[model samples]
Target chain A: MATNITYHPSPVTPTVRSSLRRQQGLTIWLTGLSASGKSTIAVALEQALLRKPYNLSAYRLDGDNIRFGLNKDLGFSPKDREENIRRIAEVAKLFADSCTIAITSFISPYRADRDLARQLHHAERPGGEPGVPFVEIWIDVPVEVAEKRDPKGLYKKAREGKIPEFTGISAPYEEPLKPEIHIRSDQTSVEDSVKIIVGYLEEKGYLSAPPEVNEV
Target chain B: MATNITYHPSPVTPTVRSSLRRQQGLTIWLTGLSASGKSTIAVALEQALLRKPYNLSAYRLDGDNIRFGLNKDLGFSPKDREENIRRIAEVAKLFADSCTIAITSFISPYRADRDLARQLHHAERPGGEPGVPFVEIWIDVPVEVAEKRDPKGLYKKAREGKIPEFTGISAPYEEPLKPEIHIRSDQTSVEDSVKIIVGYLEEKGYLSAPPEVNEV
Candidate 1:
C-alpha cells in the first residue's frame, strides 16, 4: 500500500490537472432542433469515447438530466431559457475542468446562448491558466424532417400550438455560423455521425492524451 | 485501433454507469466554518484518491470554483446563500452520477441546506434506480480557534462589523446531528484528517470497485 500521499499545495489549475490525469479536457457541444438526432449521436459518441481504445472519462448533459435536475425550476420564458443554457454551460465547464470529456446536447436555439457557452469555456482562469477546449457540433436537420421524426411528440405539440415559444415552430433557431463540426442528421447514420465527430476530435488532438503529459 | 463501439440504447442509469466504469459514484460532503481546514483536507484527500494505491477519479468543489464560476451571480444574502448551496449540491450529484468521487468543501452552516443536499443524492431516479451514496463529513473546530487562524482575515472583518451576517458570528451554524465522519480539525493533522476520512470510506467499501463490475 502506498502510504505517502503527496500534498499539492498550489491550486489545481487546468494544466496541473491535465498533467496529473495524463489527459486534456474538452466539451463537445451538440446543438440542433428537436428530433434532429442530437441526443442519439451524443449517446453513441459518449459510448465510443468511454470504451476500449479511447478509455476516456466522458459524460453527457442532455434534457433527461438537466431538465429534471438542475434546470427544473426554469421554464420556456426567454429569461429562463437563457438561465438554463447558462447553468448547463457552467456545469459543463466544471466537468471539463475535472479532466472529463463533457458532451452537451440541447437545442440551444439562440446564437448568443451558444456563444456564451463557448466564451465560458474559452475564458482565462484567475491564475492565467488556459481555458478548456470547446467544440461546437451542429446537428442539422430541416424543421420538416425533425417534425416528421418527433419521437417524443414534442414537435407535434409545438406545431399544434400546445407548447408555446417552441424553437423551429413558434420561435427561431439561430444557426451556428462557424461550428467546429456540422452534421446533417437527416443524411447521416448514427454510427457515421459519431465517426465524424470523433474523427474531428482525433484530428484536432482532443481525443488522445496530451503529448507533454503522456510521459507521466 | 478498436473500431467496434458498443451501442448502449437504454438510458444510462447509475447501475449501468457503475458497471461500465467499474466504480460506484459517491459524494463526500464536508461542512465546517471558514478556516476549519475543510479545503486543506479536501485537497489532500483528492490527491490521495487519485494517486498510486487508490487510483480513483476524484474532483473537488469549493469556493474557488463554485463561488466564482457557477454561482457567481449570487451574493451574501440569505437567499443567495441558500441558492448557492442548492446549485453546489446539484452539481455534486451530477458528478457523482458520472462515477466520480465528488468532494465538496463549504461553510454550509444551515442544516436545512445540508439536508436538502443529502436528499437530492438519496432520492430515487425516475426509473427506480437507486440513489448515489452521500457521505456527510463534519469538520468540527471551535469558533475561537477558527477565528484565531483566519487565513483570509474573514473572522476579523466579521468581528469588526465590516462583514455583516457572517457565519459563526452574526449568523449561526447548525451542527450535524449524525454526520458519517466527524473530525476535530483543531486537534488532527491535515494528513491524519485525510486518513480518517479515507479510512471511513474504505471501511464502508466506498473506495473499492463494486464486485459485480470488477471483471468488466
Candidate 2:
C-alpha cells in the first residue's frame, strides 16, 4: 500500500471543489428548434472555453451523447420526452456539481421542461448552500429560417408526415419568457454567438475562480 | 458581445479533453454488500485524488446522489434495479469521457449488471479510439461481519423482514471473478483501503498527465 498520505476528514463540497479545480461549475442550457445552430454554437463555445485565456473544463451534452447513450430507451412519446429532459437535467446538474461547465444543446422546446431543469440546478442544498448556476441560452431562430436551412432535413421529414410531433412542426415550442441569454441564430454567426455567451459568463463572474483557500 | 476571443473550430474529443484537463478520465466501480465501506473508501479516494501529489479531478456517485437524484423515478423491483445500474453506468461513462475520475459506490450485487457497466466503458468508440477505462474494485467483506456492524440498522431490518430483496440477505450477492482491485474491508482500515487504491492507480500510471500537446 501507499504511505505518507494524510486522509482529510471533511467532505468535498462545492466550495472546496471550486477552490481545488480553480473554476466554478455551471450549466449553459441551450434551447432551440432543430437547425437553429445550437449544436454548432455549443461546439464552438466548448472549444473556446477549453482553450486559453480561460482554460476552463467544459463539456457539451447533445443528441449524440444523450439520445444514443443515456436515453436510448426513451422514445418520442410525451411521457418519454419529459423523462428524457429530466434525465438530461439531472446529469447536467451532476456535472455542474462536479465543478465542470456543462453545456446542454437540445431542442428542449417545452417551457415547463426547461423550467424544471433550471429549478433542479437552483435548488437549495444542505446547510443552505447555494446551488450551481444555470444559464439558459435561447438559440432563437424563426421556424421559417430553420426549416429553410434544414441541415439534417428533419423539417422536411416532419413536413412530409414521416416524423410526427416534431418540435416546431406538428408540436408546440413554448418560447422562454426570461432566458438568461438570447441569441438570434439567423442574425448572428457561430463565433459571435459563442462570444456573446463567453461575455455573459465573464460579466457574471462565473468564469473565474474565487480566492484561494489554504485547505484543498 | 465580446472581443479579442478566437474561436477554434475543432470538436473537443476525448484526446483533446485529456490534453486540456491534464488528466485521463476513468470510472472506479465499487461493488459489494451493504456496509462494506464502499462509500467511505469512495469519499477518501475522491479527497486523495483532488489533493496535492495527485491533484486530479474526481467525483463520487452513491445513494446520496444517484438514488435520490437521477434515479429517483426508479424503485426496488428487479427491472428498476437493473435500470438503476444502467443509468449509473451511463452517467459514470459520461463523467469519465469528460476527463474526471468517477467513483461509483453501490452494492451492485449481480455480476451481469456489473459486467454490463464494464462493457459500456470498454466498448470501442468511433474512429478506432480506445474506450475509457473501467476499474472494478470489489469491497470484500463477509455478510455475517457486515450484519454484525449494521451501520444503518439495515441488517436488523433485513432479518426482521422490514426490507425485502436486501443484498446478502433476501437477494444474492455475486462476487467478481476478475476485479482489478479487491479490498477486504473487514480486515482493512478505511485509510489503508484508500491507500491500496491510490497505490494501484499510481502503479498503473493513472495519476499523472500525459505530455503536453501543442494544440489545446
Residue-wise lDDT of candidate 2 within B128-194, one digit each (tens)? 5689999999999999999998878888988999888888999999999999999999999999999
TM-score of chain B of 1: 0.92
In model 2, how large is the Cα lDDT of residue A33? 90
Q: How good is chain A of candidate 1, measured by TM-score?
A: 0.92
Looking at chain B only, the TM-scores across the models are 0.92, 0.93
Query: For candidate 2 chain A, which ten residues in a row score worst on lDDT?
Result: A1-10
**What shift in Å separates residue A186 of candidate 2 from its native position after superposition?**
0.7
TM-score winner among the candidates?
2
lDDT of 1 by residue, A87-139 (tens): 99999999998889999988899999999999999998657787989999999
Alpha-carbon runs more than 4 Å astray in model 1? A1-11, A211-216, B1-11, B212-216
A100-144 per-residue lDDT for model 2 (tens digits): 999998888789999999999999764467998999999999999
List, in the given order, the native-contact fraction of each candidate: 0.16, 0.29
Give the least accurate 10-residue stretch of model 1 chain A, judged by summed lDDT: A1-10
Provide the interface RMSD of candidate 2 in angstroms, 1 decimal place. Answer: 12.4
